[model samples]
Target: MNQGAPNRVVAAQLNIPRGTVGWWRSEDRKVRGEAYEQPTDCPQCTGREFDDVAYAYLLGLYLGDGHIISKRSQHHLSIFCNATQIGLISMAEEAMRKVMPLPTVTRRHKPGCVEVKSYTKHWCCMFPQHGPGKKHERKIALESWQQAIVDAHPWEFVRGLVHSDGCRITNWTIRLVGGERKRYGYPRYFFTNVSSDIRDLYTDTLDKLGVEWTHCTRHGNPYNISVARKASVALMDAHVGPKY
Candidate 1:
């Protein structure tokens, strides 16, 4: 079974019943005090080296739009992506695999989006911020080790956040230029989140990268972080252009 063969295949090969094979395996696991325990390669639990760059990016995605379900029988990390952005979906899946390849990753289609899930309870170990209630309703803070990872891969983290809950848009205005009407376009990036803690984390990373941003109100809510400065937008363009 460890070689990816099902019990039925092992039983047939051994000329034994499937139930008997399963029972023998169960008894062996009980003897080893590992009943119902699944093997994992989690960096946190195993103290194994992993891709910190991918982890930093995934951390941003989790803070932005990801969540973990840690129920008795259900455990997984889910990151919702727009169905139109195939690149983002692929990147999200790759990041999850790079961080922990043992978990099974799958995508489920929703009304207009795709939910990418990694089935494993060890996600809670990686993301200690998981708790009850919505993310915006609870305090979200990264542990020291996670902060170190984000610090090392700030651009990747910012890119993940932008891919999840941020967007780049261009606004144009017609102005009189030397007695002629001319149109000018301004391209800006916005990171919107209801959680102040998450927004603060994004801005803090931006500050470290020397990216200027301001709080912008939209539809009577001041939950938007605007990066409209020419140099800052250029930096963002180089690192994260848009969700695609």
Candidate 2:
């Protein structure tokens, strides 16, 4: 605390109360020159448990618009989306609370997105996909323990993926039958992502769950995957439902 910023900033970053921080850096400690230890546990180091759905959804949020910054002296987790997506912010907050009790949530000033962040050391364990560069350039892999959780709860995992980077859409087309023109619209699900590894993992999970999808694209975009078949869309609907 002494070497860090103000009590407020430290508390916000560390996800603790300012008053508690003051106690940690009390006058007695300051006079005696005692270093205060932050009362927080690391998910990776402590091996704490987490809920499947909440953790998966948080993972989805992380994959879609969230990133973790690890430095030699400091590390933090951040997720940003349009402020209008308040549900996403709330979901991230809920997941943080479930994973640990001391996580602090803060809002930052970004152009149109709402940036909510938490200060925690277990982020790397929670999301091993973190690396030195952007997600597209990184090789994202899941640990055996995490994979076990996903295997037990595949639908929750899909829900997380679709909520963050995928959406339900209606596709339409026109055709001529017997010299008569006809228009038709059909429901489908679309998931867009930049990382091929993530896209493969998503489709693999769907494969394991017996859901069908294809690498369908628009505007020459190769990163698009869709579940367009009526039955498959129904299956996706059953599990993912809606984002909010």
Candidate 3:
């Protein structure tokens, strides 16, 4: 009996006659195929091709917090970002739509972050820097066309990188001007990563944007580049604003 022990099964074990108890099983019960139909699995993605801004953003996102998982015919590209970075999620989904149009991607909540993943067959072709271990341990070099894309739309690329692995925060410190002490607060961007190559790509883009950044890392801190000068921060604000 489905619910532990139904009356019919109990009666049968007790030697009660089927017709006497009126609990015999029905002969009209349907067989497996007759009663249910098999459901088809959904396709991962259909769209193909690429865009300079979108692909550059995706590349940056991949270099930061994204990775690919491949199956026989379906390879998934997933990027993780803070939930507050809804704008980045939008950009990522839009990029996925442009690059791999068929199967759609979705944003899922994961603890303090959100994950966006889509099934595609062209992930490896897009991210040639992908390899067996952590990105820091692997050599990451962009192709000529990939470099051209980043050069053309460096802001979107930096935005993707910042949203995934960097952050924008208010940094305040007290400075002594003559005799008076004053508190100064400013918005600064910090991009921290393990791979020097990835960090170099970020710095190169910042250089093209005319934003100055310095390598800043102390104990327990990751390798980072910080853009904190007022003019440089303003330049970055104009080009790539903070993630939502």
Cα lDDT tens digits for candidate 1, 101-181: 888899999988999999999999999999999999999898999999999999999998998899999989999999999
lDDT of 2 by residue, 1-244 (tens): 6674557878989999999878777875888987665656556766765566677767767887789978877677887766776776687777767766565667785887777788865688678888888898978877887787778888877877787788887778999999999999998888899898889879999999888889987788779898988888889888787555
Which segments of model 2 are wrong by more than 4 Å? 1-34, 72-74, 175-180, 217-221
Clashing pairs in 1: none
lDDT of 3 by residue, 1-244 (tens): 2233433455678788645433233322243223321121222122334566788888889999999877675677899877877888888888877765544478889998889997654677677777788899988989887898888888888988887888889988999999899998999999999899999999998888888999898685659899999999998788777888
TM-scores, all models, native as reference: 0.90, 0.81, 0.75
Q: Top TM-score: which candidate number?
A: 1
Spell out the clash pairs found in candidate 2: 15-104
Report, for every candidate in turn, its global Cα lDDT versus the true structure. Answer: 0.93, 0.78, 0.77
What range of 10 consecutive residues in model 1 has the weakest lDDT sum?
1-10
Instruction: Show where candidate 3 strays beyond 4 Å.
Output: 1-49, 220-222
Question: Following a full C-alpha superposition, what root-mean-square deviation does model 1 have from the true structure?
Answer: 3.4
Q: What is the lDDT of candidate 1?
A: 0.93
Window of ten residues with lowest summed lDDT in model 3: 36-45
RMSD of each: 3.4, 4.8, 12.6
